[model samples]
Target chain A: MDSSQRQLNRSYLLRGLTDGIPIGLVYLAVSFSIGLSARTIGMTGIQGFFMSLTTIASAGEYAGLQVMASNGTMLEMIILTVVTDIRYVLMGCAFSQRFAPNVSLLNRIGTGALITDEIFALQISKSGYIKPFYSYGAALVAVPLWAIGTYLGIIVGNIIPEFLVSALSVSLYGMFIGIIVPPARDNKAIAICIGASFILSWAAEKFLSMLSTGTRIVILIVVIASAISLLFPVADEPAKEAAQNE
Target chain B: MNRITLYIIVMAATTLLVRVIPVLLIRKEIKNRFIKSFLFYVPYVTLAVMTFPTIIECTKSPIAGAAALVGGILAALKKINMFIVAIICCVIVLVLEFVL
Candidate 1:
């Protein structure tokens, strides 16, 4: 009986690892460009490594790097970090429903730190109820793989030719689009929101010279999400309940 | 700590707090439906916002980047694996860069 329980835990854990490996590989490249960009803006490989450990956010780090490179104040950096990371608040709330019923507070904090866009997407798409072990299995693979990529990005970015780095940098955006498309295809609200954000982000950046990228996104997400939720409050409630009870 | 080190610490702390505080405070499962669906779509939207415009800026040329974006959308629409989608888009960027 004990062995059977162990086997059950082991199988879920393995399932999680399988779920995480692809995400880890993408992190390896995406954050490599992050490490490259961080190095370009006067940070060391070690700093990039530690920063990736903490943030694991490609865009937030870019925003932070912008503040640093521009000689922006600490106040600016702090605000930028908060503004860019605002989505995590949403992701965290969604993740709350996923933890094993008896999950500890420490485990919550640990898993929270590891929840990036990739990890959240992978875990939420997971069928059936999830255990703490499953999240740990995914985190165990993803977080370190991201850190390694950052370290290599900082260390090896200098030695690599400039042209190839630009090419690799483009891969991160492809990965971002990749993550969202499958889910968006099935959900119209999501698809519309994706379309709105994409068009608005592009327009705001190219035409609205006065608005910064962070502010533009803050406005776009708030406006689009609020607008959609107001229009369609009943869209996913039943599904949410089903997921929670599952 | 010096200013740069302090800078690093602050950025890290703010991002970590954004992630951890919500999870810590909302220990019970939230029952609000609007909030749930709102959170559900945030990842897709935020990620989308990050991708466009910036994607073009990531590549050497706008045309190459646009090509890569279309390829990425295709790979995704096809329901390919995440890593393969990324790889296909990367290859598109490389080939387009070479061609253009």
Candidate 2:
């Protein structure tokens, strides 16, 4: 290959590696249990790893594993997965808007394949319009971390001590708290957003047990809370700017 | 089809469906203020809604929940590293699970 081509490849690899590191660590912590859970539910190692790779969702994967373990019908799996992952529909909608107009259809679809919560967070943190290649760069890093971690987890799942597994599993929740608590501290409005969404989610699970559609429930709750926030955004922004100036 | 393959298809289809529609339909560069603002906050709401329930569901009993609450408080205060707090909570819960 030409030097220019080699340089391009090297850049892609470096970007993937950098992007993959934190995300890979997270995948290691979360997908380990997912792999372990898949095995406990009678999935072979190959199945478990591929499931993690293809699904790329934590809650959706866990829920999917539960349904499969119970010998849920194909229809049930489809319904439950679609329901559990419907939040992604909204996530995808939001993330896609970040894409510049020039991003191609093929690139959008390909990159959209990798738009999980963590990836979305990381990608959005970078400035300027979101490019399809950047998503690919991130995915090139993240996808394998997820796939490989699951593969290893499945292979050695039975050997790992339960305590260690529990600890690793807790990291998933930790990652969430890490994401939520920081911004939540500075912005009362964001905190309110989190609280309202939490209550709605809890109520949906508890009182609306008849509506066992997890994704739909999340979608509805998010839509409601987001709509409310739109109407009544905390009037502190200009006030804060004024206070800061003073 | 096997269950695994079925799952792959469903996931692939669902993902593509969610992503491709707007890209296809909204050919004009979407500059609508309302749509833009709505998109910005949707992710936070989605993330919080998804995360809150899982923390509760992970803990089997009140003690674990209590420990998690402490861990969560510590995390919120940023008193300790998030990873360390997470491990501490998990260890406390594991011990509680063992003891009670």
Candidate 3:
């Protein structure tokens, strides 16, 4: 309510927006692929746009597209989307610790809705309690680019060259590598977990070929993370601060 | 309502619930060590699981995808910013696709 409080919130918002620029750019490339897929499944541009707007999740949206392409029922759609996005629950739990205790119910709901993998990674990487406004700021930039990119991809419909599309397809993985590798380098335990995940995930894909992608991910996360935690429990401290450093 | 429209709504609601419920419920700091540790390591594991094997299938050539994977890891290990690491991987894929 006070001028100083307003100024502080504005600054957090600006910081989030600034940090979110690269994420927005990457979303443009990734969601373009999503849009292309949507079009292939016979979705209109407006439909693709609304889908991206409502579900700012790459994997979840992709799974939904596949389900629709198969004329899968609502039950199938619900199951697949929930399975694909279950990671967000873990992310949300982690983020819950990061929020300032006084963050309102409305702010919590708003910020929680925007908790994409990239944004969650950025938020937890910061050193202190997080403000809802920061998440809001990032979403303001990144979310629009995502929805618009999907719209454009549906409208543009693969007019982009094949070679360029191939190149763009790997950007999301590159960003994922960027997030995990630095932390892995710093912590031996994290590095080991990542290495194990690489091998185990590959094995899961090859051997569990019948399982859906989302199912594989959840199973792997539960097995690997739980096993590693048992072997090397993080030292006693507030989980919030530990997550901040992680 | 149209079928695709209904699907979109279902998908959006499912995704939203996964994200929103935890923050709304877990207001206090978790004190359990294993649970805390699991949460701590969740991001690294989740990101790694999502990236690998899948990344190898994303590009035109599996070889290009593998090359990009190696290049991305090396670039990221050098403490490169995310945007640069992504661009480098894309370039690696582009050139590899051209040649191979």
What DockQ does each prediction reach against the true complex? 0.62, 0.37, 0.77
- Chain B structural similarity as TM-score, candidate 3: 0.92
Candidate 2 lDDT, tens digit per residue, A40-121?
8667777777777777787777877777778777677767776776766666666566666666677677666667777666
Candidate 1 CA-lDDT value = 0.75
Q: Candidate 1: which stretches are off by over 4 Å? A: A1-22, A30-44, A66-76, A97-101, A127-135, A153-157, A235-246, B1-3
Best candidate according to DockQ: 3
Cα lDDT tens digits, model 2, B24-84, are: 4544544655565555557557666666665667556656655664576566557454445
In model 2, the clashing pairs are A83-A215
Q: For residues A5-94, what per-residue lDDT tens digits would candidate 1 score against the true structure? A: 678768867877887786677678778878888888778887888888877887788898888889899899988888877778777876
Q: Model 3, A21-71: lDDT tens per residue?
A: 878987888898899999898899999999999999998999999999999
Least accurate stretch of 10 residues (summed lDDT) in model 2 chain B? B21-30
For model 2, state the Cα shift of residue B43 in Å. 1.2
Using alpha carbons, what is the TM-score of model 3? Answer: 0.92
C-alpha lDDT of all candidate models, in order: 0.75, 0.63, 0.87
Pick by DockQ: 2 or 3, better one: 3
RMSD (CA, Å), each prediction: 3.7, 5.4, 2.2
Question: How much does each candidate deviate at the interface, measured as C-alpha RMSD after superposition?
Answer: 2.4, 4.0, 1.4
True C-alpha contacts between chains kept, each model in order: 0.73, 0.34, 0.89
Estimate candidate 3's alpha-carbon lDDT, on a 0 to 1 scale.
0.87
